[model samples]
Target: MNADTPMIDTTAMQRIGGQLGTNPAGIFQDGNGRRYYVKTLESPAHARNELIAAKLYQLAGAPTLTYINTKAPEQIATEWVELDKKCIAHLSESERKQAQQWFAVHAWTANWDAAGFNGDNQGVVNGKVLTLDVGGALAFRAQGDPKGKAFGIRVDELDVLRSDDGNPHAIKLFADMNADDIKQAIMVVVQIPDEKMRRVIIDNGGSHALAEKMIARKADMAGR
Candidate 1:
């Protein structure tokens, strides 16, 4: 874990709102009085996927909510944001373009939850578009089941990308990303230490074949 990542202390956390997905989450103050939204996960797969997604986004220089792992409740704490809007209507043309480009990170990670109800999973913080809730990434299905049905849009789906009524901008944005952009994003994943990466996969009950498949998929995407 990075030294700067915020680990949750249950005694210091307090529930502030409704649950997020199957996890019960809420706002909490850290030892330093900093506030964060913490979501608890019962599944080891969710935890592992969350951590890996966060690290990949950070390494790729993309905007995502910062997350820290916790023990007791098996939770992850993300930086809190207030007063976020869904549609890109509020963003300037330049910001919209940047947001479109930044969405390449999602394509790289295969996050199907990128666009929530009215863009609930994405928001503008400090005048920048930041992607949130990447727990739905990497794996083939919603539960991160390798043999499960594919959940999100595959990287190769171009036509259906713009068909989303909820947040067509997301699909359109991702569709605009070229192979090099995706390759650049996946390059960061390739840079992670093999031991560390393998440990995360093994600890999460992921098989060696699954890991190899993930790597191979990224490599194939880079080549296309």
Candidate 2:
């Protein structure tokens, strides 16, 4: 599950949820089944950077994700621990406590020392009182993290809270990603074929629009 692993043929991955504006590569299983997503290396340098970032997060013991190497196309696969819908809805007080515990651990390793913190989130899942997005705690400010000093921490936080509010998570995660390596890890995924047929999203300095353009271009080539 390290960066050195091979890529998977994620084309066979069943799309459970609608694509989010943030992580265009976003894929999920229903609240019932295991979810999996595959990311490919569109460009060599970006892929290496992303792989390094992922590996660094892992090394830090962050609860980010397991990066499986699907070398077939230089793709990366992520884990899918599916939560029960019913469980996600009626989150027990104990669940909230656990969420707080997780938050503390996340904050510590994720360099809460450098980045600032946010309000304790009301864990709502699927429109219910579930453990939604957790670690959105921004740094003291939105200063750019171009060298990715804060990316491993922030991106790990976002991945840990994906099912909470995937769309919002996607947006926030992309913003963070842009600050780190916009042209590399974030923008490179625009090469995903068949994504262009979808409507273009406008946000985060036209990141989504750029994704749409890539998708559209692929669609055009497929037609030709």
Pairs in steric clash, model 1: none
**Taking the tens digit of each residue's C-alpha lDDT, what string does model 2 give over 21-48?**
1223556443446566554334443343
Candidate 2 local Cα displacement, residue 135, angstroms: 10
Clashes of 1: 0
Residue runs of model 1 more than 4 Å from their true location after superposition? 1-6, 19-23, 83-89, 140-154, 157-160, 163-169, 172-210
For 83-142, candidate 1 gives per-residue lDDT tens digits of: 355455565666665666545456556666565434456667777777767776676333
Q: How well does each candidate superpose onto the true structure, as a TM-score?
A: 0.71, 0.35
What is the lDDT, from 0 to 100, of the residue 82 in candidate 1?
73
lDDT, candidate 2, at 33: 62
Clashing pairs counted in every model: 0, 13
